[model samples]
Target: MASAADNPLGTYLRDRRTRLDPAAFGFGGGRRRTPGLRREEVASRANISATWYTWLEQGRGGAPSADVLDRIAKGLMLTEPEREHLYMLGLGRPPEARYRPVDGISPRLQRVLDGMTLSPAIIKTAMWDVVGWNRAATLLLTDYATLPPDGRNILRLMFGNAQARARNADWDSVARFVVAAFRADMTRAGGSAAAAGLVAELSALSPDFDRLWRDNDVVAHNEGVKRLHHPVAGPLAMEFATFTVEGRPDLGMIVYNPATSADAERLHRLLAAAPDG
Candidate 1:
């Protein structure tokens, strides 16, 4: 028999409670004892019995079904990633019921990345793992591929590693954007093992990450400016465009190009001059 401490339902409920704000949920501000929403509030919002909800919080309830967990997630106002995390924890369903990993890229997508000769193009997983990159990307960004398998996370590289500061010109903006993007993904995915693992790993490694994660701020990554101190090109100011690969939910393609004609020429010259390694 598994102990209540090992119960995923209880763990999720507790984590959710820590994430909620009383004022945002319309709870009266007074001499409140608890840190977040009350059990009754969560239960009523979820349309579940208070006793049963309590059991879940106490780690007494077994794994919940997808439908039931979805209701709870809705009641808690969880984002997509958060809901997915709730499910992955065995509080709801298996990975098949949730997300599918992008096993590989199609030839068309590969060609697309390769076709952008003047721009640095790359593909990444939801967890920020680099799935593929073009030759131009290698010349533009140094040591990106040299990272350890699990060290490919942009957030981790930016916050946990000091070397990133030298490589990136606007580290502050980059950090904020990445953190916000991560928060957005968390909401979208509902907190799968991949998400949780990344969060845990980053939190443990970086104090700044721990502080930012606790803020509970959420934002999506769409378009942004990328300032890189390219070894060959010198300082390059680029605009980044990110697009989701259709039929591949786990993969996203990001392309970077100079914002101006002059910078574009510089990028072209830089890539041309670089030795084909």
Candidate 2:
């Protein structure tokens, strides 16, 4: 079933291999005609046989397994997107989602966040890790920047952080819904090892998490009205909607709009009083 169109995979791998600096792989002193790591060197780094890797680059090794492709990706120092590309070209599918902490927002997305001056907006991964937020979001929700990268997880903060628990007007109901939504996400990810590990860690940390996870409840939190007990602004009525970012199904953008004129006025005052960064 192999076609010439898929030849790009072999070409891409070769290009990546040639671009890798040999010095980075501790081959600084060796005399080499090529500017990058040799094929055998890459094979060694990827922990595969030279013959197999050569065959792979020659497009004669047939389709590679996910694990092998992943190793090659690491060996070549591919970015997340590059790794995904390598898998797609080599295996005709993307690799399963793994837990890796990311706190990056594209410049375009950052601008979108900045534009939501009145509405609180946040960008989260499929695993519910808080990666980016606007000023309003920090004022309403917890200040994601203040939390450790790993601690920015919505579920983790909900269950373990006292500050987050205090911000919720209805802790019990919100916690149940959060757990259910998280369960649904985990299920959709095919119950990856990373998801299971997160569940295990949370289960051990919070009794509530343990109970809810065991119950096997699942739901999608597409949109809802949330009552938040803001520390400075007091009670605020907000309607939030979740949207999946185009081309990045792994990310969701949640925006919170004030439900009433009074709430909007209060948010405006709070934002105005705060120093602009």
Candidate 3:
């Protein structure tokens, strides 16, 4: 645990507490010298004693449980990053990740994806749902924009789409790797139970998926070579890597760069030949 002199957890708590609009939370016990809710009011919201909260602010309280910190975080209405920061200050590590469904990426993040004109890039949730992609990805990889909302999942495409399976140069290896990595990602995100329905659905739909899931192999999706035989472009070899989206443990971005200059040229020509371009 970080000491008060260095970590300043108390100072952070006081700052956040004082910055809040007391009236917004239905707190109205007359105005005082300072702003935000009083210590007792905050304690009441957090369901802890006023003395304990005061001691926490004074750095005299002992290390608090994750439950206590979570309550305090909710009471303060902390944002995700703010809650994580609180965990880091109160504890030595971050809190366990809570999986949140990501509807889409930000405009700024979409701009980052769009900027990858040559490199095929995609932003996916921990559950392998393709939430965002660029033109290159659509041309060289799967056309995510045209797919139905449920059809955007990579695993479903891998196991359920015949065209998708046909595109893989080494189908068996890639399929196995995808299954293992998917398992690892969901487990790390603490969403294994949440994904049980998908697992069961795919298991029944594809025998290959059933076999792979039964293997119980877990692997990390870091960097690897991916070969996809695009119908228009023929065999395409790309070096693919997964990256964690900053401050979002539930999201990742994958960028696939052409493996060789020839492949790059082929991609460039393919992009140029697209009717949409």
Candidate 4:
């Protein structure tokens, strides 16, 4: 049989607790038996009984509740990845998302998006806010850099901007698809509260938005052909694909590639004409 100290959950908890600095967390230390905080100190920080904490370390404590584990994780001063690991150890799955806004993507992710030279690529938040885009997106799609932050939202651009509507080959079909996909994507990303303000505002402003939202239809933003009537390039058909950013459930990437040689040539010409954008 495995030793009590060999329990995976207990081992993980003990390891993380030992990794914490007692002095940094305002715990006074004169002479300590161990390198890290004592079981009592950890228990005190976690707001649990010291005895129970001891039981947990010895693998005698029953499975800890998610709430208790959360408290313990906070007490340990765990980072997001560490907290997630704690949840996975304590519970059988990861915890629910805390629903924070994504300010920006990492440099690696930005590089990945930027690497798509001819392919228009954009990184968007769960709430459909365009947080990052490549030069191809500016040349072939919308000029995201020129727009203010709020104006970069996919939903806002689709419904609020007349120019965006005119650019779509079939605005009604595209709008419906976007609304459905938005519903599914936001829900999956646990962004309902963040999306609520935009939802309410758009519903009040656009009857189409109100109707589509009420329909309660949901669609996956998988792969599809998008037709747009670009002012500079004329009618263009592009095949677009969506991908979830690795380790980032709150962000999604969409890449659009020209469906035909003619469309590709048009995008190339458009890119060549745009001066150092």
Candidate 5:
């Protein structure tokens, strides 16, 4: 039998396995004795040997590394909190924050966005995909609804789309800022496969993105001043700040405030003229 300290990890793993719904992963239409995934199934999904996984479950295997734990977490489709708990139990420490792509937003949060009538606000995943936005955001930025789902990624639009590139007054500086911030995000995510894939795709798509990514710069998305040539309004100056969404640390919100009264009036006029979608 394993010691008290060692046994909890195994017990936790067992509990997670039992709670996981098999059908969610396309393992449906099967009759089984147990409620959740079998040891072999989890091992297969995690790309580890069945015997090794069994050993870990039996508490005979030595402490798993962080990388191994991460793989298991992904394999099990563990939520961020669950992944953190797994790391604490398995490795005696919490894992670092990672980029998580989330689309779900509570109605209360949407109401908060809606209430910010004067500010252009948008909620984005760690990868900078625009998942939610207020009316002011749609007016200030491109109408997200008009773009393809995948095209809503901020970095992709900034670098890959001609319209976005043309809208920015200082494209080079903004591009650098985006690349640097994304690099830092990737580091926090432990260079996840999703991050790697996005990098690879962007590098191939835009020469500027490729070059900036290779420059190896890193930055935090805190606050910044922006100057843009709005197609209708023209020469809009704004100040923007980013905040982590409450209860969802992996998601971020950017709120753009008008720097001058003139800009505020311009936004109001633009919003008034724009059709509600």
Candidate 6:
């Protein structure tokens, strides 16, 4: 059987406590032995025994019940994601369960993607899983449909594979942006088993990923530029834009297109000449 020390609940509690500010929580600053709220403080706020809280922090207490955790979440003033994380650590739920998806892409939005015949557009899940794309996107980007399930993760491919590196001209900047974006998602979706699992997998798979994850950085995937070495079109520079799905909050659609008229013409010619594969 796994001990409390091995459990994620304890670690989650410890991490959260350490991150809280006394001023933010309306606590007075005095010469203190520890940085954040003491175990007794959390226990008192949550209406629990100090010993129980201490034992929990020490990784010796039994798993906390949902109701009990709710009390702690309230005491800690946890955000929605933070509350979900507390539950996940105490219990176990996938990350997708924690966040309500935005309004799924409307037909209007679908039409927008379809209208951009010269551009590449793809919709991806919160975990960067590709959900949908237009035919032009498929043609412009590498044949992502042909890749194996695990290999399809854009971040995984960017960092883990040499072939992907060879195709991108500005690999370093792209890598930084990707890591920052992923870190942002992890912050919003922290404590999810799926998200945690993804982080663990990436950390183990690439040393660059391990270094970047340790930085504790975060950023939204709003917009960016990418230069790709297409097999048929050769090198092309493109600007990318991202839009969140309205109903499906967990989905983000990103589109890419050549930044210059000449590049656009080159892309059209290449696509026209390309053989059906």
Please give the distance, in angstroms, between residue 172's alpha carbon in candidate 1 and its true position after superposition.
1.7
Clashes of each: 17, 0, 0, 0, 0, 10
What lDDT does model 4 reach?
A: 0.85
Clashing residue pairs in candidate 4 are none
User: Which tens-of-lDDT digit does each residue in 1-277 have in candidate 4?
Assistant: 2364467777887788888788888888687788888889989989999998788777776888977887888888888778878777777787665446777778988898888887999998888999999998987778988898888999999989999889998898999999999998778766676588999999998999999999999999999999999998889999999997755666789999989999889988988888875
lDDT of 1 by residue, 224-256 (tens): 788888766778889998997754556778889
Q: Which candidate ranks first by lDDT, i.e. highest?
A: 3
TM-score, model 5 to reference: 0.68
Model 2 Cα lDDT, one tens digit per residue, 17-118:
989888777877668887788899999989999999988888886899988998899899998789989988988887765544456889999999999898
Q: Write the per-residue lDDT of candidate 5 for residues 1-277, one digit (tens) a residue.
A: 6765659888888889988888887787669898999888898899988888888888987999888898888788888788888988888877866676665578988899999988999988877788888888888888887888788999999988898899998989989998999787668756778878889999999999999999999999899988889999889999999998754666789999988999888878888898877
Per-candidate TM-score against the hidden true structure: 0.62, 0.69, 0.91, 0.85, 0.68, 0.59
Best by TM-score: 3
Judged by lDDT relative to the true structure, which candidate is superior, 1 or 3? Answer: 3
Stretches > 4 Å off in candidate 6: 1-115, 275-277
What TM-score quantifies how close candidate 1 is to the native fold?
0.62
Our tally of clashes for model 5 stands at: 0
In candidate 5, position 228 carries an lDDT of: 89
What's the distance in Å from true for residue 125, model 3?
0.6
Better of 2 and 3 by TM-score: 3
